[model samples]
Target: MISNPAKEREVRPAPPDPALDGLLTLSSAQVLVLASGGCHSGYAGDLCCCLLAAVQGALTASSYAQSHILAPGQALALYQCGEFSIQSVGEGVCMLVQLQGDLPGRLLASRLTDSAAFFPRGGAAVREAVLSLSVLEDEHALVSGTAASSYAYTMLTNLISGPSSEAVIGQGEPLSPLVEAAVGIIQEEFPFLEGLDELAERLEVSKAHLIRTFTKQTGISPGRYITHTRVEYAKLLLRGVDPSITYVAEASGFANANYFAKVFRRETGMSPSEYMEITPRKEPPKRDPFLW
Candidate 1:
């Protein structure tokens, strides 16, 4: 038995519909389970092929795992004390189906990139959801249909095959549907925002690409989008007290009162004071001494 025991298992998360997911599924795999156990049992085990293809989401074992590719007519006579999973379409051993024209490493990187915004700290929510789901094993029927299906699967390939740490993303790099989907989610969450680099880091796309794609897809640059949203929000505040021109500048993200005054005049075509004056006076605003 090994001192620090390990477990062996195969995991496949596929969806039924290539339209929704599982666009380009992996090829079938004929897996043999062999174990020299210090975990499930203190005994050696024999190797066996799953008599049939069973595409499954989660396979749990209390022992370490390893598998080898096999051509037809090949077999192993070995043993394992733990469990394993297999995906096959016939009585023959399985071959993992790589996506058509898919580059595994780049595809995987694209997938992980989708969660870049919350990665290292924020991906727990998505990871948990992925871990809990089982459809990722069901719909990989090996053929992708429709242009959308092909596009989606291409992205999945990018994810399962992670990019090198220093990998450069070129126009040649495979893009994933998940990447675009993640960007959409980020925009919705922080419509009026700063710290774009942090946000881009979380989204997992390069800051440059994020900027370009967002503008191409949405017709507005990221910085402009945030500034416009912030300015819109400031208008709501302007309807209240804190009508001082300097105060409005500070509250509206102007670094200096003079700068804020300039921007406010440009955006609204009037100074903050002038805007406040145009707004009808209501009842006297209650003030706190702390505010003064």
Candidate 2:
């Protein structure tokens, strides 16, 4: 978003590399920018907040690759620092929206669209957005154009924020072609996979292509993104326990419950049910602007 989409990703190359540059944006504290990778993939990150308080570097993996976000200065920190490399977090992609710092934390304040979902992973959830300075008022103005175009554009923003009373602004340039296509596949085809190869087929994209596009746009691999989504839903089930494990397993795209249990433990550091015990089971409540 900081640069034009057609402009190449200034970060690292496709394979493991010591110099990977990843980028995202934050316009104002009231406007938020979220970086997300694939859903449950071990290395792919889920949506994470832009440091709202301090004006300094919000988060970083290493010194060399750091984001200097102020209204715009930015950089990418890669983990391939030494000879040994850890799978980079957010190596895939992240999203930026103008937000209302006026609202505390991740309170989805209001939505700019109704028919679209906020996440590419799936579900029809309403989410708030921060519009770009060019797009009209930062917090006002509806997403326009064709239904599909608006939906897709809004979906991109929503994927970063998800369904909630959020604060987002979609006034940046259009997405990279690769990112646009990759997110499209993620939203439209992820629900029908039997395995990695099968999922790749649905997009008419190769395994490598899927991974690269997703990583570039969202900062993680497609497989990992899929994993992140399934696991997140699994977490809800494990915590809420409203749906049985078997049901969660299926809904989360796990072909077998036992397999789901093993992976869930690895990703979350606990079995599904076990995670619910220590982590607690409730969404972070919405902020009361009145209290502050």
Candidate 3:
């Protein structure tokens, strides 16, 4: 049986959504998470720049009568000078960083011919950096405002001017149809997935071939990917009010609570209860008016 740890710490309230008009006045960078199907919009003349990067799943960004689809590891920058909206494509998790002043301008001055630009390729470093920021935010580790700002600035600067070489597959590389289908299934039906053999069967490939191709292309094995997807889903559930560990375990595809705790600890270095102590309780879901 799992021990309840939600009672140990005072749950922090969710941060208020930042006002689009007030973004220009921010003294430090602000990170916002866009859940699946959620939408965020800003009007023209907001006087701030934002970097939107897809962490999981995908995103659709629209502005100036243009729309672009952003797969994981892809990013785009918006100057907020014209009306724009970002919507998650499915079970997407995206990170949006709002910066004050001309920080983004200085960082991307050399690369960005237009203020609003899509970086469909070569954003792997940027994606990794933003993902780190997301982890920091979720773990409540950014207690020092200055430290957070410094980290955000460094990430933005590196994104535009850093070395372009990538160790794994290039972020711009298009996914193969087989791999893409596998990823979509993992994201949408992680809880129901039996194993890599099952995935391989569905994809009409041998298990060994599936492992080789998935790891070669995505830098991770299919088994590990499924584990990651399930863990992420469990994290989301834990952030809600008074979640039960057993339920989370079952819902996240773990066969039993004990196994879930073991895997969760192996991946995160903390038990579910300990994680709950640090993560802020999320507010109830609501629909945004700007979704398209």
Candidate 4:
């Protein structure tokens, strides 16, 4: 099992490297801009608390055994931060606000825990605020002085003071591209993706290699993720106008309603009919106000 890093408060000592040490402990924390498919992977050292805000494009990040994808206008509160790996899905830029004092911890805890998650639309103000910080950092060299430093510090403080209830947990490591491609195929062709052979043939990798690579990257077997996705789709159909279980099962790529029901119960902890009774029909998500 991947142990929870958030519960541990111990700080690892900083290594004896001047450049890295300065980079981590900078008064004006580093602004990293990653191109498409680029990644930043490493240990956190002494810098445990941080604010990760996406500036452009999308970012898939994994830290503390949890992974999340952040698009523009989204941000994350990361704590017990250690050995994080953030990769740009497309062209993206992110600011790493290294927490230095007790206030950072106190403010972050009020808004989020190690698992706190925020929706795409809700983090607009926060993202904009962080983007502004990056802009200031870029211009700092032009106007280097106490005044510039003070302004940056104040901005960082104002950031934590905003409404933090939107925070939510981001869990899991990022999937490698090859594994992600295989997942896409399974999700789209749930019925045809019958066994390891079919999936491996589609991916052009050996069956054993595919299974091992996919499981290692996603922390879940490919078969399990595929099964789970189908069940989730079935639930959506069940809650819709399609009331026939057989139709729902077929549409969800299941061969029979009885089999569908059994899988659904095992995965959802309830019968299909019972699930429909308790769960509300989900509406399509509204456009994120933060997205232009």
Q: Top model by lDDT, which number? A: 3
Clashing pairs for predicted structure model 4, backbone only: 66-171, 66-172, 67-171, 67-172, 115-169, 116-168, 116-169, 117-167, 117-168, 117-169
**Residue 67 deviation, candidate 1, in Å?**
50
Residue-wise lDDT of candidate 4 within 1-292, one digit each (tens)?
1111112111112232232222122233444678789897745444355556664557887888578888654667566567788898976666554444333344345666454444343232333233333344444533222322233233334455433211211146666778867765664345435666878887889988888998787667777777775675565456542256766676566768898889999998999899878865432112232123
Better of 2 and 4 by lDDT: 4
Candidate 3's error at 194, in angstroms?
13
- What TM-score, computed on C-alpha atoms, does each candidate reach? 0.31, 0.38, 0.50, 0.38
- Whole-model lDDT values for every prediction: 0.34, 0.35, 0.60, 0.54
Write the residue-wise lDDT of candidate 2 on 1-292 in tens digits.
0122111111111221111111122222122222332121111122222221111112222222332221111212112122111122332222222211222122322321211112222232111122122222322332222211222223233344433211111234455765555444443233345555765676577878767765665556667766665676455445431236665676556877898899898887888777767854432122342244
Candidate 2 worst ten-residue window by lDDT: 4-13
Q: What is the lDDT of residue 51 in candidate 2?
A: 20
Off by over 4 Å in 1: 1-195, 282-292
**Candidate 1 lDDT:** 0.34
lDDT of 1 by residue, 120-194 (tens): 111111211121121233335332223222222322322232122112122444445544443333323332234
**How displaced is residue 1 in candidate 3, in Å?**
21
Tens digits of per-residue lDDT, candidate 3, 1-292, equal: 2221111111122232343222122233333355668787764344567677665567898887567788765678776547888887775655566655444555566665446766653243343333334444556744333333444444554466444223233475788998888876665456667889899999999999999988888888889888876786577557655567887787678989999999999999999999999986543212242122
Winning candidate number (TM-score): 3
Candidate 2 residue-wise lDDT at 2: 18
Following a full C-alpha superposition, what root-mean-square deviation does model 2 have from the true structure? 19.0
Q: Show the lowest summed lDDT stretch of 10 residues, model 1.
A: 114-123
